[model samples]
Target chain A: MNVEQVRSAVLKLSVHNDAVLSEQGPHCPGSETLDIRHFGGEESIVRPAVTDMHFPEVVFPTSRVGRVAGLEKVRELVVEHHRLIWHSPLQPIFGGNEKHFWKAVELTADFHAEVCGGPKLYSERKGHPHLRERHFPFTIREKDRELWLDLYVQALRNVAFPLEVAEEYWRWVESLSIRMINRRTTFAEPVRVPFNHIAERLA
Target chain B: MNVEQVRSAVLKLSVHNDAVLSEQGPHCPGSETLDIRHFGGEESIVRPAVTDMHFPEVVFPTSRVGRVAGLEKVRELVVEHHRLIWHSPLQPIFGGNEKHFWKAVELTADFHAEVCGGPKLYSERKGHPHLRERHFPFTIREKDRELWLDLYVQALRNVAFPLEVAEEYWRWVESLSIRMINRRTTFAEPVRVPFNHIAERLA
Candidate 1:
């Protein structure tokens, strides 16, 4: 197992743990660990017994491939991505508008997960996930999509899934999200200010 | 999950990805997402059909649980935790480390998963996981563990697992890894440093 795969196993264990709520996999160090007596003696080496994270492989759905793409992976990404966007040293500057920034983060995170191979609630449960239908509600202008895509690309890079995988995935997502823009109505209305694309920013 | 579980998952996924080599498990999106196509062309939103990353869950022996602990909450933590860690910038760094670090990350990840309640590799195969025995082959010093744990804990915080759970999990992990340090027979021992306890690093 690669590091990510083992991580995937640990995550899957948590999925199995849905009801019980412990993480009896690697990094845990086990319960015998709870018994401090093993440590006090001379040269005594103790390996703690895992209390409860492992489980039947039956617990997980069969489609998640690699260390990178599971529902569990998505949830983990969602939480972390949100934390970075909403809680970082720079995020507070958004101040009273923090919710908007987070909403955008959530939006991008969902879109990014789909790109990286995570589950999709908005798209799946609902249908076509009309990015426009959903995002149409936002004041998403071209600048917004560009900015959104910018943060999104960063998140994708931050996640660092395999390059080809990410390329194949984001190539579609970045383009597809364009479907969500209100197009004629939003863009034609004219007040939307534009910003540089990712390439431009880098240049 | 509470951050302890998140930390565990990240620890596991961020490391150990290269260990077993073959890709296994965690397949399929929810059934609701199967086989649909992009609808509006420009607005193309489709069902969550299978991506390459998606895999069906693989079944493993229940006996594997003996190695790891924390059986109480495996369902949610396993896949979920890895999801977050897999995305972290640290993942690439860990993947790039030497074999020793690679193995250490895998073992510790196994340790975390077991502690929080997932699998059991340590006990099933190695009996006690004699940390010193397993580690003596390498030049592991206290500083090594400290640096390792630092990166580990940083990954956890970056993922934003709840602080209390994070701290508890960290304490347990930190407490355990300390035992892995074997005296250096070939080099002068670095001065023992004060504990860099991470009790206060919370979001």
Candidate 2:
């Protein structure tokens, strides 16, 4: 077992209290103490039970505000963000085509609506977001993520979101954006654009 | 840019000569020397130039002995291997249903045929076998990989694969099996099986 698998298990446990975490065989015995504890009270207090293992410090938003500016407001910001990306230098990442751009916009809007404590539009319509798998065809980089976040920042200002609300929402968006980065910036060779041959044929 | 990304880029480059491998922005400037070189005398020799970077030693068989055994013999072994897995404890990993089992069998056979230099049936039909993404829904551990490998080992013997050929084939299978493992043996909590809610509803 690697550090990543250990971390994944710990994170999964931190979220789901009732789930039993185990592997099929005897390996990585050091993770025995990596667990979570819940204290009974008016407010259920939950905390990590292990400190020996090197766990990366994660800054979770303490606020349960859910929708910082409510569902409609979040949707509006998301739509604006997608619109900017549709016309921005990052357009090629979304296929540089109108249909693909709009489809991505719709998907993001639905995803944003669902995540911001609104209707479960994305899950109901698209099962699970599987964002990594969805973006696998594209070689996303740090610049692309920054470009994406910049659009959202502009969208937040355009929508007139409160400073605190915008900051909180930005925190989540920033972290999520980092998760969607699928490629490295210093590769020995350039990753081939998903279907260069097909595009060449069309050209 | 990081060690993992650098390693992935080099490995990808080493395998596919025509593959254009480039990372986005400049991050790891040192990787410029970590490259492959082609020497032409009688046969073009290709290998990694840099040794400082952490790269797993991969033994790629240069001999195009496509099918160690004949294609028909390989197919026979692959069929038996899947049949054994279908009835074994590993069945649950493939969905534990007849339809899913058979579909998996067909896909694996196609994949095996292609890898053994038989035909491009798998790629032509299914595109790139995003094997990791395909198995992402399942929590695959080291033990599962061992079980899968065991089935193949037994099947190879059953088909009377030549000892030298079988050993060479086993080397590749063992390495590929390691790549398929996506999880560890112990977690802080159990992984949420894909479609848990739906399964509960059905039960």
Candidate 3:
């Protein structure tokens, strides 16, 4: 589909989202953005990279509601707690070729550990995914990297994990995000601003 | 959103649909003209609805393909069985209360029985939705009714319902769509149509 069509589909999915758009906006630790919108009729533009981001809410389809509500808190918390660290600037970028440098970070095992509610879901599913080591094959463009982050956000955003419970989780995501990137040796853009110390680039 | 925004959203959603604007247009059953801009995004001020329409192969979302494959043979057919019926000419203008009238009919128990595979799902948990009696309290306004229909199309389109195995089931959905309304006595212009005969306008 062209960019506009993609945006239209995303918006349609967003409009009746009683399942995902709980209480108006979504909060995650270290999510990327894929802002979809229409310039005119039917056609859409997708800004697939996320910066200082927040998931504004829309109505979710009904079927998803039960699934979100039904998730075990421990597993939910496990995912949320890592959000902050994942988005942190202190971490190093992934060093080699990769589709999503951040996703390649060796952090999911740790993220699952924080879930405490249901840690076994991850540990038993697979021991651990080595980060930098596993990402040496795919070509990672800036756009592709951003898209990976966007998808990660999507995976986490739809399942409601509450505000207070989710905030701390976000912090962990931010922290882990810094460690996911290995491009510190080459590119010098998309300035990584610190969480609490996010600087205003404009007057 | 304001009326203009709502209208724009409608225009975008309808016009941007890939299935409606393919090289092979309006071949699917139940397809209707909607001033949709065809591929190549050329601006078109007006285009009429076709009586019958089908979705393009790629228009089906990846998520839907997996779901449609799992539905029982009958449930799968509910997507577009009665194009001949819904395609029939109607006194009411297209996009008029006809679609609204559709939402109303589908809210009935009798209409539910006739459709191939739908009778069980609606009442399985919610019980018989005393549609006419319940609708007495609510008169859906012109705009709300239109939006309501739009919402249904968004929710129901393709929806993983299989092809012919689901055809009879779809007839029932089309049938029940008429029962959703309770406007028994009206002096409104544009003669009202029977719920049962809706299949005629849809093909």
DockQ score of each predicted structure, in the order shown? 0.03, 0.02, 0.01
Task: Name the lDDT value of residue A20 in candidate 2.
Answer: 20
Best by lDDT: 2
> Best by DockQ, which number?
1
- The ten-residue window of minimal lDDT in model 1 chain A covers A52-61
Q: Local error of candidate 2 at B13, Å?
A: 43
lDDT of each: 0.39, 0.48, 0.31
Off by over 4 Å in 1: A1-203, B1-108, B184-197
Ranked by TM-score, the better of candidates 1 and 2 is: 2
lDDT against true structure, model 1: 0.39
CA lDDT, candidate 1, residue B128? 46
**Candidate 2 lDDT by residue in tens digits, A25-44:** 22122223312111111221
Put down candidate 1 lDDT per residue, B70-184, tens digits, no spaces.
3333323333444444554324323334564546545555654544444555445444443432432233334455565665555555555544345444444555555444321
Best by TM-score: 2
- Between candidates 1 and 3, name the one with more favorable TM-score: 1
Q: Tell me, per candidate, how large a share of the native contacts it keeps.
A: 0.01, 0.00, 0.00
The 10 consecutive residues of candidate 3 chain B with the worst lDDT sum are B51-60
Ranked by lDDT, top first: 2, 1, 3
Q: What is the lDDT of candidate 3?
A: 0.31
User: How far out, in Å, is residue A31 in model 2?
Assistant: 32
